[model samples]
Target: MKKLLKNIKLVLFFAGLVLVVFLANCGLTPLTIEVPSVVNANEVATFILNCGTEPRIANTDPPYTSKLIVGFMVPKSWKAAQNTTVELISSEKGNSTLVLIPSAEKEAASGLAWPDAAKKRFGIGPNLLDDFEWLVYRSVPAYTFINNEDIKFKVKISSKVGSENSFSRLGFFILSAKENLRPEDTDYTKYAFSNNFSVTNGEGDLVDYVNPQLAKVEPVKSLDNDFISLNFDAGIIETTLSNTDEIFLEARGFTKSGQQIAITTKVDKTRLKPLGGKKYRIDIWPRGLLNVPQNETLDRFEYYFTNAAGNAKVGYGNTADPFRYTFKCP
Candidate 1:
């Protein structure tokens, strides 16, 4: 018995219980959220989360101090963790820089990384697409909530957006350090979403996460070394290809050294694969399709759809002008 007791490790269950109880009494409520509806890509945009914590009577002298764990749901392409910075201003704790949580820490409830766990719980919020990630951070030192006094906090997020002209619903999460994202203790956690945040000044095709599109380029941004796909749905609008039994891609790739290469000859190589419902797509290697020299770089591609015989053509928005796709990946 003595040997067993010596080998056994001791745990402080009471301290843990006290912290949980204190969190149950305190509540985080959002007063206002300020985030721009539209911002240029690669520019620093500011988001302010204004909230207040409810007052609660202290069970112990220290009142169960805790550090704030905050998370933001953003586009994966933005690489927010590396491109963003966070600051916290509180009525109680003064000012402090919010530090990113270590990547190795697992969420207590989900047994996954903090960012992945957040995605599993709240998801992509109100956005229609699923190409976003959660970036989590925590406040330095700990905060001690005072009894009978509401504590207010302002979290400022400065992030440099990615180089994609896309829109998404940004999400914000707040909770105490020990609370995490516990399923049973969900009430202690708080979250809010922005309304269709958009990026206007970006390169290549517009990636709208808010709605379904009729035409799109696979790998929205790519270079000559990448395999590209042009996808279109003829039924979405009345076009020359909408009535044609067979559709073909008519494209001209421009080389950096001022050379025009045409990939549209209405041959077997240019035919689009039909996916029923008037949907069609064709995959192509930019370098191979244009027969471009490795020494030369591609500038962009002007393209359109054609009938089987190559007479009728459909361009941007069913206009006579050809649709253009720029090779603008960095």
Candidate 2:
């Protein structure tokens, strides 16, 4: 009787161990997220996610079928830029998938293999198998809320497992612009000057003269922040007054509450050159330049030009109509 009882207990123990291993292999493991404890609303933010074990990639036909999804939640009053979708591919030998190209096309083009294509796409070194882990970088543009209060941002990650789904939360982190000390005077008034002064030649006529004209105004969508690029016609300014006169682009950003933010003289070094004959483009990054009020949306941007000579023109000609760029601010 004692020997029979011991045998029964041994059998039960083995069964329980097998059951635990099966459950672990079939179950989903939560991913660990690493992010900054505090983030600046005026700068780009990044997050990294780590998985302990190889995530199961459903053997789907399409390579681009999203295996992992990430989302961000901000305050109702605050706005966030568009979300980026990252598709995770299997890195296992022979099981590696190339989602960049369709399977049909892939099979048709027989000369190059899928592994070669993946190597090129991922910029993997020669010893690809040695590097088992893959890292993806995602950036979110900076944004500020209305009030000085701290704001929490939530990040969520989900993965599809067979017919069900596994989810993980990254929790929340505080984002604020005021937490970090900023320049007190963010207005561009100091850079604002008169546009009445001009230069003349020995003939006392407008010779070799150039008046700044608004050529093109467009929004630059980027991971840093939504910025405005202003192109100006510097006609002969490059050769004529390139050394003496300083050209400045002025822009006024208005909030829904009627508060005004401006970018006057601050110019990026890269955009401080003449594109061609009298063509200059100035890109305005609003992070530190445009002081947006918390919660209020920037509805429109009014742009003009000024120079050391104070004779810069606003539009194409003297009688040109008023121009402004409108956007759905977030």
Choose the strongest candidate by TM-score. Answer: 1
lDDT value, residue 243 of candidate 2: 46
Worst 10 residues of 1 by lDDT: 5-14
Indicate which candidate wins on lDDT: 1
lDDT of 2 by residue, 182-230 (tens): 1222110011111121211111112111233345444321221476566
TM-score of each predicted structure versus truth: 0.71, 0.30
lDDT of each: 0.81, 0.36
lDDT of 1 at 255: 90
lDDT (tens digit, per residue) of candidate 1 on 209-280: 766555667776688889988887788788767677688888888998999888768777788889888889
After superposing candidate 1, which stretches have Cα over 4 Å from the reference?
1-27, 30-32, 40-43, 54-65, 74-79, 104-112, 119-133, 144-150, 161-169, 181-186, 198-211, 243-245, 266-269, 274-279, 328-330
RMSD of each: 8.8, 25.0
